[model samples]
Target: MEKRNQKRLDKKMLSHYQLQLLDDEDKRSVFLIKLTPLNSLLFFTFFMILITTLIFLGLKYSPLKEYFTSPTVENQAAYKNQLLKLNERILELENNLEANELYIKSIQAVVSGNIKAEKVDSLVVNKFHLNPDSELFKPSEEDSLFRIQIEKEEMEAMKASKNTVPDAKYFTPVKGFVTGKFDLTEKHLAVDISAGEGDVIKSIADGDVLFSNWTPDAGYTLIIRHANDIISMYKHCAKVYKKQGDMVKKGEAIAQVGNTGELTTGPHLHFELWVQGKAVDPEEYIDF
Candidate 1:
């Protein structure tokens, strides 16, 4: 009896349980699996370890990690970059506004003839404040070439001044009688010459036609730019023979006399001369 009991205990320790699948009606076993107590414990332990490892891998590498991260911290870097760009744009706009204001003030000064000599001197000094002895301020090859050209021009101008004639030669635009004269006080900056209708008018000098257009006050008008900063204007014309930008020779026919514009009472030519932006008496330079 003692021996049999010991045998039974050993068999129980190594015993395997049989798992069987059987047809319900025939009661015949179709599949079977055997698992000992130790084998079952090992299989369960391996499955649990595998499941834990898979869960850890998914959280580490997949998008599920986003849920655990703080969104504000992640977006803060992007926001900082945008803020930096905005600041740069604001600075650029401020600089542009300041430059435009300075330009407008300069134009106003020129138009009102209020630009002071001190202002000009200050501008020059401020623009050229760099030390002349510095290597960075030294002239390049291009600058040397430009300086030579300017010096040559200055020499030519000096020679021309030495040989300058007492009177400048100018062709009479037309043979007519003067009805109105230049008077700065009255704001009549031009001379009105009366002649027969359709009388041919000529250019006083070789120049490029700057303007050729019609206006309610001047009617058909033409302006020419010549050398030495001289400009001539012809107004109240019956017809213009040249277009804007056309090169005209001295004594070339340019227009015809006419009684046009609201200010005219009869057929006449209104001619004006400008030297360096100031209106001058045309009779002083050219005969009617």
Candidate 2:
């Protein structure tokens, strides 16, 4: 009876082991793990949520906030200041360039334009100091216009002492066709004639050589003083035959025609007649 009972117990343990090994959909074993696909998905979702939350909180309180705001808030002020300063500097430079351009233009005009200024020790171009608020810059009685009147008065005073002939007999210093006629209203006191270079220049009447020298305007000039306060001026000559103190006879060869003066345009002679210190028309006495 003991052996029979031992055998029956052994058979019963074997059947229980087989039953635990087989999968049962209806009746699962209690006190045993029951893992499935749904359980795994739930676990993974919880882990992901916890990790994401931890990361978001860590970054929110860190230096990441300042890093993001730097380009918009702190740096913007510096960038704007730099940009504005650059614009202002460019504008100032542009203004300076314009002023320089105008100055260059004025210099060019002065260089190219020509004027036969009178040969006297007059004032050359120089800067004059004047108040910006003064009337000297304006045109009026007390301004440049008025100053011009004062200058004209001064000119008259000086001219009163200058030697000008008005009534001397007109003489053709050179034999040539009249290149230019006299215009009285224009204050042209001389007549121009086209003469051959080195041609003989004859004195119109008896006179004493007053001056024989090179001038800026009259070129190589010869001035003769005659009786009755009569004077004659011969300009644009190559050679002066008489000296300053030499007396010359009428129709005598006194000089050679040439273009020597700064005012001469070409080979020509400029002749002037004066009596009583005033200019007289050359056409009145000479048949040119």
For TM-score, the strongest prediction is: 1
Per-residue lDDT value at 216 in model 1: 69
In terms of lDDT, the poorest run of 10 residues in model 2 is 115-124
Residue 107 error, candidate 1, Å: 16
lDDT at 254, model 1: 98
TM-score of 1: 0.44
**lDDT string, candidate 1, 45-95, tens digits:** 999999999988887788886677565765888889889999999999997
Give the root-mean-square deviation of each candidate in angstroms: 17.5, 26.6
How accurate locally, in lDDT, is each candidate? 0.75, 0.68
Clashes of each: 0, 10
What local lDDT score does residue 69 receive in model 1, on the 0 to 100 scale? Answer: 58
